[model samples]
Target: MENEWKIDASESDVLIKSRRSLIDYMSGSKNNFKGHIAIQNNEVENASIEFSLKVNDKDSNSDLKLIDFFENDETPVIQFKSTSFQKVNKSINFLKGNLTIQNITKVVELDAEFIGYRDYNGTKNASFEIIGNINPKDFGLYYNSYSSHNGYAVGSDIKLIANLEFKNQ
Candidate 1:
């Protein structure tokens, strides 16, 4: 899809926005996410896809965050239950709850959503980012090395990778 589209960053952006936090001790809230898509023949409509997310992380927070985002559509979408549904209303509710993580250090897949064709610039390249809040309870470290919040994230170190493809029809 080549429409000069850009994923406008939001305080609620679904992806992580800072890599410094992954290691910086002074880092505050954190976010981590990943995605991939492919188009063949023409393009897959967001209304007709059933995307699947496979998230992994050494920190328990990452796993929990991924789960939070994987919410089902409350309202009926199209004539089925898939991520590719073009119904915007059917998706708004679900997208809002997209998961979140805390103190993630290990590598893991974030998510995969089915989608209808939406003109993705031109080719389905692996595009990605991460930004959001992360809890400290999951991490083995604490603020100022304090004992009260020892369960927070430890040695922050995060990475993200996105992948997409275009196949000839």
Candidate 2:
């Protein structure tokens, strides 16, 4: 039997990291996201997630500039819908999904780890860590020419790490 689980937003987090140089990077996190997963026999059957594309970086100026790169006013949300899940082991799985950003959708493969289940306050909860990399240019996010000159060019790839907790529903 497949069981449905709703994400516990308060206990989940999505982190974003973008490198501007070899040693310089900006990181931010988001806790406001909605998602659900269907699991059968301890394996994920399907999953989908959606969240606004806001990066709460520590530096206000950097945050604003990053948001502009994403054209947030025009396309404000990022969405993912799983198409397949391939179990690699008891704990690791490869989740292939369609990721939509800036009105462009691309197929991406994410590394998902099943962190097991816990009974918290009489409710069954599951935890997972999903990680992936994406190129901003692929989503039509181009780096500013001024910022690219010298040694300030932002890296092409952005790293995404999601720590998700879901409650049985």
Candidate 3:
């Protein structure tokens, strides 16, 4: 329990956002996933996360994207493994990791901030907020449907935002 933390799925969230050419319609997914974080002496040492974004999930509004855009059947789970961690300020930090999506792995940087550790009902919890953006093309999601007066049907960049909580274990 000294150097390891278990993800509290009940208290965590993974949200992705992207827009389409039509100003009114936006494509995105709000997922609840599980993962772990390893720390030593208050410094991040390692981290790993795995999550399956099922199109049928209640929070998923883009079923067409799951089949045509991402092809979730071939690659069910999206994963990330941390390679390095850097502290930019007292609360802000950087996580360098490889994100594997649809069998394509790319190195990505995640901006993370420590939300402080506190004891809640006798349980010690550490929380963090991470944000980043990735190009869908990098992960083989290159399908594009252009509109006449507008731009491409879908945006190229997908923004990822996560709020995660881990319990000392």
Candidate 4:
């Protein structure tokens, strides 16, 4: 049987940082996501990856502004599924996937890196980092406003970074 890996959601962290050049400027992040990855030959092998985030679970250490960023009542969940994986090296890789937001799915690419493995407590674990950028407008999460300081209320790109750990369970 092939080995399967699962994300240690309790120990892993997914932080999504978004920025806006509004009149006063705005930037924040949300940490909390569930993800999994398939491994082969000590590297990511195929497209058996999945990630999900609950809109209502977003936190920015201030007000709950993410709720309005997403239509939680209609699309409570944001999802991502891998379509393919390309290994660049032992430490670097690329994942082509689909990200679904508010029922809209768009093709996206994420840069991944294997940060090596470790023995935490009594269990073996693997660590990785994934980074990507997306245009919120592509997912129907557009915030348009003519900024007096600049051009638009928010930039077209939103950056997402996740430092994930998988337990050999």
Question: For candidate 1, lDDT tens digit of each residue in 1-169?
Answer: 5222222112112233123322221111222212222332333223111112233223534312322222342321111112322223421212112222332342222333323333345644323222223343333322432233344443343332222222222
Per-residue CA lDDT of model 2 for 56-140, tens digit only, reads: 2335443324554654354355667777777776777888888887789999999988787988888889888788988988999
lDDT of 4 by residue, 50-157 (tens): 767665643335332444566447545667787888887777789888898888898999998877689899898888887898787888875543443235455567
lDDT of 3 by residue, 1-169 (tens): 3478887777776666566422121122344466677776776655665444433343344423434564436534456666777776566788888888777899999998877687878899988777898887888875554643234455678777777788887
Candidate 2 total steric clashes: 0
Quality of model 2 by C-alpha lDDT: 0.69
Which residue pairs clash in candidate 4?
none
The clash tally of candidate 3 reads: 0
Q: Which of the two, 2 or 4, has more lDDT? A: 2
Best-performing candidate as measured by lDDT:
2
| lDDT of the structure predicted as candidate 4 | 0.65
> In angstroms, how far off is 166's CA in candidate 3?
0.8
Q: Estimate the TM-score for candidate 1.
A: 0.23
| Ranking of candidates on lDDT, top first | 2, 4, 3, 1
Give Cα-based local distance difference scores for all models: 0.27, 0.69, 0.65, 0.65
